[model samples]
Target: MSSIVKTNKFTQALSDCIRSNPKFKAGQSYADLSMWTRLCVGLSDTEIFSMLPIALRNVWADEEIHPLLQERGAIGTGRFNVQSLAATLVCFRRTETQNSEVRVLQSQLAHLSHEFNSLSFSVFDILKRLDRLEAENVTLKQALNIGGLSDDPAGLPKTETQQISIRSDQDAVTKYVL
Candidate 1:
């Protein structure tokens, strides 16, 4: 197959992948890194368009992409050389399998990220419910004039529950901000 077809096909495949997964938010670091990694792998270390298939060579060499890929080590600036591309390919291609493993790990991280996002939302929801319940309880206590504050706030389990709650709450808050 032509490298153009191959590169286009690869780009499309990556695009489809990100599109299918809601977790792979566009413009995010993960998306950028994934794209760069694919480009690094697909472009065979940034040789000229001629070195690739005739159709696909100049397709991605737009002003915007040229510098970006160069920065990512996908392409060299100005000219294209088979030797450079070969060296780069040799150096990086060896790592392709390892990179594949990293990508798998990254995908797993993405899955965990989705899970953590869901769980964090759930935790926040529970905290909101707890707040509402606590408010209602306080109202009732005030209505009944249940006097005397708890003498031992420190008696609350300071170990497991509190730690988990604090960590979860912090995580939720952090995710929300992000």
Candidate 2:
């Protein structure tokens, strides 16, 4: 069969399989069914049909399904099995759930990054203010003669005056103000 024919057959088979089970019908929405179909994109109809028995035995067996399949005479017809179809549906649901969780985490991380940047700017501003305050404190001490040379020039220690003058001039010029 052509690829298009095969795809159509596979689609029909999967739909029929899903309709056969009440659990799949009630639990899955149209969107969920579409997602399950998308997950089967790479598989050929023959391959998918071939997996039915194994899928039914391993993944989708239930008392209700068995009676329904028997009533329709679909059991042992070499068609799509519930287990096989369920495996694909389960995988698609899990992928969607994880993607949603990842999106939530990414948004949270972006918010945290913004908060950190704002806090960083605030800290920088505080440091600048502190530097300005320290510079003012030094200037005030000198003006009040609280920690500088004695008022009388004759009373100054000769070596200390030279060092103090040079240091104070540099401090006055380089002091940072906010």
Q: Which candidate achieves the best lDDT against the true structure?
A: 2
- lDDT per residue as tens, model 1, 46-120: 442344333224434445444444454443333344344434444545566788899999999999999999999
Name the regions of candidate 2 deviating beyond 4 angstroms. Answer: 1-34, 37-82, 146-178
**Residue 169 displacement (Å), model 1:** 52
Clashes of each: 0, 3
lDDT of 2 at 156: 64
Name every residue pair that clashes in candidate 2. Answer: 55-83, 55-84, 60-83
lDDT (0 to 1) per candidate: 0.55, 0.59
Cα misplacement distance, residue 39 of candidate 1 (Å): 22
| Per-residue lDDT of 48 in model 1 | 24
Report the lDDT tens digits of candidate 2 across residue range 31-140. Answer: 64564556456664455545434444432355545555455444443333455455655566557669899999999999999999999999999999999999998787
